[model samples]
Target: MRDTLRTRVRLVGATMAVSIALLVAVESALAHEEYVVDGERDVAVGEFLAESLTDPFVVGPLLAGAVLVLVGIAGYLVVPPVERDVGAFRAAMGEYRSYVPWLLRISFGIPLIGAGFGGYFISPAVHVQARLLQVALGFLLLFGFATRVVALLTLGCYLIGVVVRPILLLQLEFVGGMLAIALIGSGRPSADHVLQRVAGTPGTLYGRLDIVHDRARVFQERIREYRTLVPTIVRLGLGSTFVSLGLGQKILRPGIGLAVVDKYELTTVVPASPELWVLGAGLAEIGLGLALVGGFFTRASAASAIGVFSLTLFALPDDPVLAHVGLFGLASVLLITGSGPYAIDRRLEPVETEEPADAVPEAA
Candidate 1:
């Protein structure tokens, strides 16, 4: 039992390590279609949708894929996991819970700084300079100084920009990143933790100087109970982002997707027709997005998202790496949190009842 538990822990660690590696390695190909492809050259949306939808080749495969997914879901719900294995896995994962806030901070911080320096407004596609605002927010988030304040500021900026330029919606995952950070606050190794310690310590120089620490502590305490919603918020935000990208960017606007495929010569990599490539990619994203939103197989969905982001980087040499840094971080957070609260996984968990002390133990 101990050996099996150890092996599962090692496997989980290895999977996360590889996922992070892939995210870091695929930096060269991370830019989105809106950044490179010219919008004026795009085909009419009506024409593209009609042609793609009517094609038997595309529709047939998509239908079949949907059916397979439905069947898989049914099977998963009917089959029960080994209770011992589930317990071991959950125990292994429980140790990482404290790191969730740190993960959320890094995920939002770096991308925000990149966007500021890169001359974008929360999204790579929206080329509006708010460098000072974003950079300040990013630095504060990374430093874990007034982290919740910074997160709220980040969300506010993104929302205001969305009102001005609806295209900013492409990077909707920022919403999740910010909300999660706001809820979790800066975990250990942050300036917030250090400041809190100093302010709480008697006769410390920093403690005497700290004016807002008490108020901040009060605020953090009030919100701590709601932290469990972090995972659900992340799932919804990231899932919707994926759904929009798949449907709006690819299926609804194939001209742009095809341009990307042609420019990158993606056909050579997969040996498939350009239409199939576009359709398949779109469908795959939608499937992954739905799984995430539903919180079904949450960890696997997140891992797959990380894989997809990395694969895109490898496939598209011109894709800007900074644009996707946040996405990599958000997916990593999901990998850590799994399907927190209100998830299908939660409902699927087996109930455990206490056994009498006199009950005999069964042999493994």
Candidate 2:
């Protein structure tokens, strides 16, 4: 029964993860459609350089540095083994656990609540019903209250919202985040943890918030177990984003790609014609994107993506540069870790199967 429940939980998680990847793809296409400028156009090189500097020149390395600093502090200062880590130390505690499953929930949950309240108080003409509910979701996530329920419902809310902004259906990474929440539940240290302690039994409580998994245990062990999830999400996000952009903007609409490329004024810097460069980049993206999706040569593709996206960052204007920054981060992860457990790279690896029970065991 425990195994069955675990399997179900994993299934839910997988579904959510895939959904998020798709969502990013869809939303990105729509977002791309809205793009109107080639960042390095008629504007002076000085102007471009000035603007680029303002937008974090190296998004991944910098954000990564911050995370590492926080982790260092977490390992040194918060160093777990206690409970006062809550109230005054909550923010610090969060940074300590920022890379864990619970981090995704809190990170996303805060925004949901903000949007909910913002809609309720500010947007006089938006999805009133959804906005009101998101406020509650924010609180639930913050407290880790009925987490699985909140996760499922949040996925539903995303689906409903997608009907309006069907483009969100493309945002697969967010879906992956939700899936992680549903599968992993809110680590330890929440109302769910407290209630589970009160129950003192290993079983489901309040539908699927998971009270049995030691809700009383303030901090989670086996942090290493969830390590693969980060890469999986990264693969999906980077793969899907490239596939959509390459197939949609470059390959299929080369004319449109040409139009965008024509705006680039980097001829003095780059010897190749802008239009030819765009076409060549499109083909390169498609090839690399396919490799990422297939999980073949995952590291190579991801590394290429880092370079490709970095250059694209320079070519595009403000909004796209911001979006590409996030892409570079995703690519950087796959570059470091490869495709992860779920990829074809792993699947194709040779594994020794156990000898059949009825057959004589083979001599080593």
The TM-score measured for candidate 2 stands at 0.50
Write down the lDDT of every candidate, Cα atoms only.
Answer: 0.71, 0.52
Q: Candidate 2: where are CA atoms >4 Å away?
A: 1-33, 36-151, 188-234, 264-269, 306-310, 320-338, 347-364
User: How many residue pairs clash in all the candidates, one count each?
Assistant: 3, 16
User: Tens digits of per-residue lDDT for model 1 on 1-364?
Assistant: 6875565445334433432332222222223438666542357767766777788876787788789978976776687456477567656665676677777777778888888999988777888788998888888888888877788888888767666666766777777777777767777668888878878899999889989878877866554445556777778777767776787677766777888888888889877677777888887887888788788888778999999999988887778777777788778877766776657877766352212211211000
- Best by TM-score, which number? 1
What TM-score quantifies how close candidate 1 is to the native fold?
A: 0.80
Residues 229-340, candidate 2, lDDT per residue (tens digit)?
5555556556665776665555544545555656655554666554445445565666677677667757657777878766766666543343233355455545444565
- Each prediction's RMSD over C-alphas, in Å, is 11.1, 14.4
lDDT, residue 315, candidate 2: 64
Error of 1 at 158 (Å): 1.2
